[model samples]
Target: MNAEIDFAPLLPLEWLAVLAAISAAAVVLSLVLRSPGWALRGLAALALLTALGNPSLTQELRDPLPDVAIVVIDESASNAIDGRDAQTEAAETELAAALDALARDPDAPMEVRTVRVDRRSESVEDADQGTRLLTALEGAAAEIAPDRIAGAILVTDGQAHDPEVFSNFPAPVHVLLTGREGEWDRRLALQTAPAFGIVGEEVDVAFRVEALGDAPEEATRFARVEVRLDGEIHTVVDAPVGRTATLPIPIEHGGSNVVSLSVAMREGELTDRNNAAVFSVNGVRDRLRVLLVSGEPHPGERTWRNLLKADPSVDLVHFTILRPPTKQDGVPVFELSLISFPTRELFMQKIDEFDLIIFDRYRRRGVLPNAYIENVARYVRDGGAILIASGPAFAGVESLYRTPLRSVLPGRPTARIFEQGYRPEVTELGERHPVTAGLVHENAVQAAPSAEDADPGEGPTWGRWFRQIELEATSGQTVMSGASAAPLLILDRVGEGRVASLASDHAWLWSRGFEGGGPQAELLRRLAHWLMKEPELEEEALTAEVAGAEVTVTRRSVETTPGRLTAASPSGETLEAEFVEVGPGRWQATIRAEEPGLWTLTDGVLEGVAAVGPPAPKEFENPVSTGAVLAALADASNGGVMRLADGMPDLRRVRPGRTAAGRGWIGMARQEAYSVRDITLTPLAPGWLMLLLAAGLALGAWRIEGR
Candidate 1:
C-alpha cells in the first residue's frame, strides 16, 4: 500500500507572501516594544493560517490489465510461390495452440488477434504485401487501445515495398518470415507505349527483360511476343533482351485492342508467375468524313475550310448556297455561277455516308423543307454526328431553333450577344473531360489570333466568344460555360448520334489568327472524333498494346477518378492493379501476361475485356516448382529461416506475462484477481471535555506569563 500528501490551497502563493510580511511586522513590533505577549500572539496567528491550508493523504493500488498480441500473416502472390503454403499452415497451427493454452492458463494476461494479408489477386498487377500489413495494423489499432498492446508478430517473407511505415509502431514488431533461401529469378517489364494510336499506324512499344539474383551473366533468354487483334494473332516477334527493344505494332481496327506479351522463363528458374503481362491500347480511325454547309459565305466559312483542309486524311465536301431557294433571279439555271444545292442527294439519298455534318451560320431557308429537316434529325439519331455553329440569324424568326432540328440542338438562341473580350476558359468539368481536357489558356498560345489589337507576342490566349445562346441546358454535359454559368459548348447524345452546339460563330476568328489562334485544330479534332464513336474518345474502354512479349494495359473512363484494374487468368486467379496516366484522359500500366490463353482483364465494376493467346511457351508453365525463390524473404527478417527439408516443429504453450514455453506450443496464461478493503477514523477533541481543558490551559498560561 502507498500514501502521499496533497495540499488544496484556497489562495495563491502571492497571498502567502503577504501573510509572511504581516508575521515579520508582528515580530519586529514585539521586539521593539519589548512585549512578550506580541511574540506569542504572532506565533498563534501563524499556526492558525497553516491549519487553514487543506491537506489530505492519497493512496493507489495497481492490478494487471490484459495484454493484446497481434499476429499478422502474409498471403500475397509471392508467398504462394513454392512449399511456402505448407510452411504457412504449419506456423498457423503452432501459433493457434500457443494462444489456446494461454487462454486456458489461470495466470495469463494476454489476448491474441489474428490478421491475414492476401494479395489483391482480383486485379491486373502484382499486389504489395507490406501495404497490406500497414492496413492491418491500422485496423487492429483502431479496434484495441494502444496502451494494452504488448507486441506484434508478422508471418511473412518480408517482400514489402513500404517498411518505413512500421517505424512508428508503439510495440516491438517481430517477423516470423516464411520462405526458403537462395531463390533467384527473372521478370518481363513493359517499358512504354502510347495509350491511343491511329489505326493502320505503327506505334512504337518499348520493353525489357530483368534477371533477378544469380541469373547467368552471359545467358540469352529468347522472348516471343505476339500482337493480337480481336483475339487473333496479328503479328509475332522473337527478341533478345537486356537491351531496350522497340517493336512497331500496327493497329488494325478502331476500338479496344487487347494485347498480351509472354516471355519464356529460363530452364530451372525460381518462379514463372512474373514472366508475362498484358497491355491495352485504344484504336482510332485514321481519317474523318466531314460535310460542311453554309447558307451564305462568311468569315467562318473560310475557317471550316482551312481546318478540314489542314488534315490530309480529312475528306471535306463543302457546299455554299450563293442564292436563296425563293429567289426568282432572271439569270438562267445554266448561267448561274453556283450549282443547285444537293439537299435531297445528301440528306435523303446518302446521309449515313458522312461521319459529321456541320451547319455554319445557316437559317431555315426553302432549300431544306420540314420533311428534309426531319430526315436530318433521323440521320443524327442513327449514329451520325452533327454540329450547329450558330450566328445572329439563329435568333431570328427563320432560325433552325423553330424547325424540327430544334429538338436535337443543345440550346435555344436568346439573341443576346456579350461582346466583351474575355479569356476563353474550359469549365471545371472540362479540365479533366476528354473533349476539352488540357485545352485551357495555355493551349491557346499556339492558336491563330482573330483580333487586330491582339499583340503577336501575346498570341491567342484563351479569350471569350462574342455571342451566347441564353438557353437552359436541359440535357447532356455542358462543357463550356460563359458569364454567370451560361452554357457555351454543350455535348449530348440524341438517338445514338452525338450533337454539339457552339453558341458563337466567331469561334472561327480564334482559329484564323485574329487574337492569336488557340488549340483550334485539336479541339475540333477531339469533337469530331468523339462524335464518330472513335474508341479513343469513348468515355470508358479497356485496351491493350503489345510490343514483343511485354504488354501495357490501359483503362480509360470519363470519370476522372482512377479505378483498380483486375486481370484474371484461365486458372481463375485474379490480379487487382492500378493504371497510371501517361497522357490526357489516359491511364495505363505495363504487365507481362506471358502465359497467354484467354486472359480476362476488368475493372470488376465494368465489363470483362479479354486477350487471347496460345500457351506462351511450355517452359514457364510450372509456377510453384522452385523452393529457393520462395525463401528469400525469410532471411531478410531476424526470423528462423528454414526449408521443408528441415522438418516442421510441434506446437507448444507458455505463460503469458513470463514468456514461458512448452513443448511445441506457446501459450499466454490468464490472470486471476481478488479484492479486500479496510477503514478507520480518529477524533481531534472529545466534545465539552476538550472545551473545558482548552479554557483551563488558557488561564494557567496567562497567570504564569503575568509573573
Candidate 2:
C-alpha cells in the first residue's frame, strides 16, 4: 500500500504573500513604536490565513503471491541407454521429494512445475537440453504469473544434439547431469551402405575409427576387420585406430548379400556391443530375361503374363501351343489360324536365351517330342529357373509327370484327383522359414482380443476348388499344407536351378472371390520373388538395421532355431547376447554399434550375421560444451545459466521488476503498483449561510476596532 498528500486553497499564492508582507509591515511599525500588542495581532492574522488551505490523504492496498519453480526432465533415447535410466529415476525421485518438502515448508512460498523433454517423432535431431529448458520456462511464464516463478532446474546427460537454439528463458536454469566421467573406448565408425550394388563390382564404403576415453595418446591399436559376403568371409584386413579406412568390397553374386564389419574393444572397455555391425546389400544382375511357354488358352493364362509384365526389367518371350499335333481340327493346310509351337527354335536352338521358363498349366499334348522335354530339363540343370503351375491334365494320360521333366518336379502326381476347399496354411517348418513366415491366417489377423478368443474348431478359411492333383512329397521343402497336413506347396533345387509345384490349379479362385478372398496377389508375388532369390526370402539370412549408433541385429533361420548370439569384433573380442522373439518365430536383438569396422555376429550353431563396414552418419558425434544455446534466454530474462559440473545453487528471493541476479536472489528492489477501491466520500460544507456569516464577522471586527 502507498500514501501521499494533496493540498487545495481558495486563494492564490500571490495574495497570501501580500497578506504576509502587510503583517510584516505591521510588526515593523509596532517595533518602531515600542508596542508588543501589534506583534501579537500580526501573528494571529498569519495563523488564520494558513488554516484556509485543504489537505487529504490517499492510500492503496495489496496482497502477497507465491513464486513458481520449473523443472525440466530429459526423456530421450540416450537417457534410456546404459545406467542412465537408473540415474533418471533417481533424479525424478529427488526432484519430487524436493518439491514436496518445499510445499510443506511454511516459509518456502514456491510452486513447482515439471516439463518432460522427449524425442519428437517428427524431428530426430532436435533433442537438446538447452531448447528443452527454454521451452519449459516459456510455458511456465504463460501459465503461471511471472511474478510467481522463482527459477528452473534441468535433468539431462548434457549431450544435446542441437546447442545453437538456446535462449529466451526468463528464469534461472540449473542443470542436474546424469553420467559420470568415464572412459568410452569405441571403434571408429562407417555408418551406412547403399541399398543396391552391382555384382562383381568394387564399391567404396566410408568409415572412420577413433579411440575414445583415456586411450593412450601415443599408443596405437590394430583392429582386424573382415567383410563377409553371403555368410562367407570374402575379405579381411588389419587397420590402426584413429584413422579413416577405405575398404573396396566386391559384390560376388547376383542375390541378397549380407556384409558385416567387426572391431574389438580394448582390454579394459566398459561395453563390447559397439564393436560390430551388419549391412544388407542387394546384388542385382544387369538384366533378367524370361521365356513363357503356354500349353493352351485358359482362363488363368493372363495371370502369368501380368506377373511378368509388372517388372520393367523383365524381358519376356511368350509362346503358346494353340493346338496339339494329335488334335484334328479340320482346316485348309494353307490357312493361317495360329502360329506353330516352335519347339525346335525355342528349346533345341536357342535354349540359353532366357534366365527363367514358366509352363502355365502345361501338359504333354504331343506338341513337342519327348526329346524336347529332355532338353528343357538340361537347360534347367545348367542354372535356369523352371516354374510349373499344373492343372488336372497332369494326372491324365497326357501327364507331364511321365516325361523326363518329372525328375525336377518337387512332387509326383497320382492318377487320382481329390477336390476340396481348404485354406492355405504354413507347414511346421514353414513358420520359421523366411518365404512363408508371418503369412498364416492366425498371424495375419490384426490385434488378438484375448488368448481365449481364438477359435479352435474353425478350420483355416480357403475357397473350394473343383480339382486338385494328388501328389507324393519328394526331397524338397513342403512349404504349404492343406486339410490333414497334406502338402499343398513344395519347392526344390535341382542342380543350380530351382523348381516349385502347387498341387491345385484352383488357387485363382482366391483372387476371384470363391469364398472369403485372401491376399492372393501378395502370396503369388512373394512366391515369385523368392524364386528370384530376393534377399528378404533367404531361408537362413542375417541382417541388421541401423538407427543412429544403435544396430538392431536379426538372424532369420529356416532350420535350427537360434539360441544365443555372440558378436565378435575384428580384434577378436566377443560380446554374448540373447535372441529376443520379435514375431511369431523370428529372433532379434539390439546392440549399440558405435564404432566403424567389420563386425561378425554368430549364433552358437556356426551361423552368423555381419555388418560389412561402419557406423552411420549422426549430427552429434563430437563431444563439446557450449552455453550459447541457453545464453540468450538467460541474459534477456535475467536467468542464470549454471553448469551441472558445479553443484546446485541456493535458491533466493528477488523483488519483482529487478534484474534476476543482483547482490541476492531477489531481482531489483521496487514497490509494486497497488490500489484500494470502494472509497467513501462525504461533503463537509452546507449552503445558504456563507453571506450572513461573512457580514456578522465583518460587523464584529468593525465594532471592536471602532470601540
Instruction: Give the candidate number with the greatest TM-score.
Output: 2
Q: Give candidate 2's TM-score.
A: 0.52
Worst 10 residues of 2 by lDDT: 121-130
Instruction: Provide the clashing-pair count of each candidate structure.
Output: 68, 35
lDDT of 1 at 63: 58
lDDT per model, in order?
0.64, 0.63
List TM-score per model, in order: 0.48, 0.52
- Candidate 1 local lDDT, 59-129, one digit each (tens): 54545566677788767656665666677778778777766665555554567899887765212332212
RMSD of each: 18.1, 10.9
Off by over 4 Å in 2: 1-131, 137-290, 296-303, 306-316, 322-356, 361-384, 391-407, 413-470, 477-488, 493-497, 503-526, 533-622, 631-707
**What lDDT is obtained when candidate 2 is compared to the true structure?**
0.63
Find the 10 residues in a row with the least total lDDT in model 1: 121-130
Candidate 1: stretches off by over 4 Å:
1-287, 441-460, 545-555, 559-562, 578-594, 608-707
